[model samples]
Target: QISEATDAPEAFVAKILQPLSKKGILISNKGKQGGFTVDLDKIEHIKIIEIILATDGEEIFTRCAFGLEKCSSEKPCPFHFTYKPIREGLKSSLSEISIYDMALKTEQGEAFLKI
Candidate 1:
């Protein structure tokens, strides 16, 4: 449903599922009733960071401002200092959250904007 609503491609969907499937965070069924569904018990164990990295690639959160090949503390980009905190915060949040938490919040109408 989410994929259909967002019009994401199958490859993108597969990418998002790959790591989770490997980690048993999501279970894929095969049959007439087969489809993807969350494993609530394991969902909280999988960090959102994994999903983000799998689907969008880590560069979305950890890319240099100047597109340098190996930007870091020693070889900082012009905007590295300014970008560092925001990037860290984003990484921190993603690593901390889980699919289970998100679903509960959504069910309770406590977080996120409606589409």
Candidate 2:
């Protein structure tokens, strides 16, 4: 259902969900009627950053915005300083945003996962 709604391939979705399940962000059951389920009690504590890290890996937070092989304070890219603060702010916001909060906004029509 989620794969259909997201318009993603089932295999792709399963690959992504596996990491989340292993990270304890989601629970997966294996059986004829098995599917992934989230623990409602922990949903409010699940930050967006957790999901990003689980599926996308740490590279999202560490990779150079300009696709440079080596970008750092010692040898910064042209867009590094300009993009650094924005990247930091985005990470901060994702850390503070919970899945519950996102659902609430979606329910209120304030946000949409797909448009």
Candidate 3:
């Protein structure tokens, strides 16, 4: 169901799902009648950054704006200063928006979940 919703390949989705299950973001059952299910209340309490870190790792918090391999505070890229605040703002915003809020927005037709 989750894979169908994302329109992503099962193999790829499974790879991501495994980690989430391990981290208690998802519950996986083992049996013929078993599968995975999300605890909406629990998920609602989880910050988006947790999911990002679990799935994409910390690179999302540290990637260079110009995609430079050596960019940093010392050897900063050309766009470093300009991009720093924007990235920080993104991180802050993402931290505040929970899965429940996103779901509510989409459910109310105020957001797009499929696209």
Residue 103 in candidate 1, Cα distance off native in Å: 1.2
Cα shift from native, residue 48, model 1 (Å): 0.8
* Candidate 1: regions farther than 4 A off: 4-15
Clash statistics: count for each candidate: 0, 0, 0
Worst 10 residues of 1 by lDDT: 1-10
Q: List residue ranges in candidate 3 displaced over 4 A.
A: none
Give the Å error, residue 6, model 2. Answer: 2.0
For model 3 the TM-score comes to 0.85
Per-residue error (Å), model 2, residue 16: 1.0
* Weakest lDDT window of 10 consecutive positions for candidate 2: 55-64
Residue-by-residue lDDT tens digits, candidate 2, 6-80:
788899989999999999999999999997999999999999999999988777776789899899978999988
Give the root-mean-square deviation of each candidate in angstroms: 2.9, 1.3, 1.7
Candidate that would win on lDDT: 2
Query: What's the CA RMSD of model 2 in angstroms?
Result: 1.3
Better of 1 and 3 by TM-score: 3
Q: Rank the candidate models, highest lDDT first.
A: 2, 3, 1
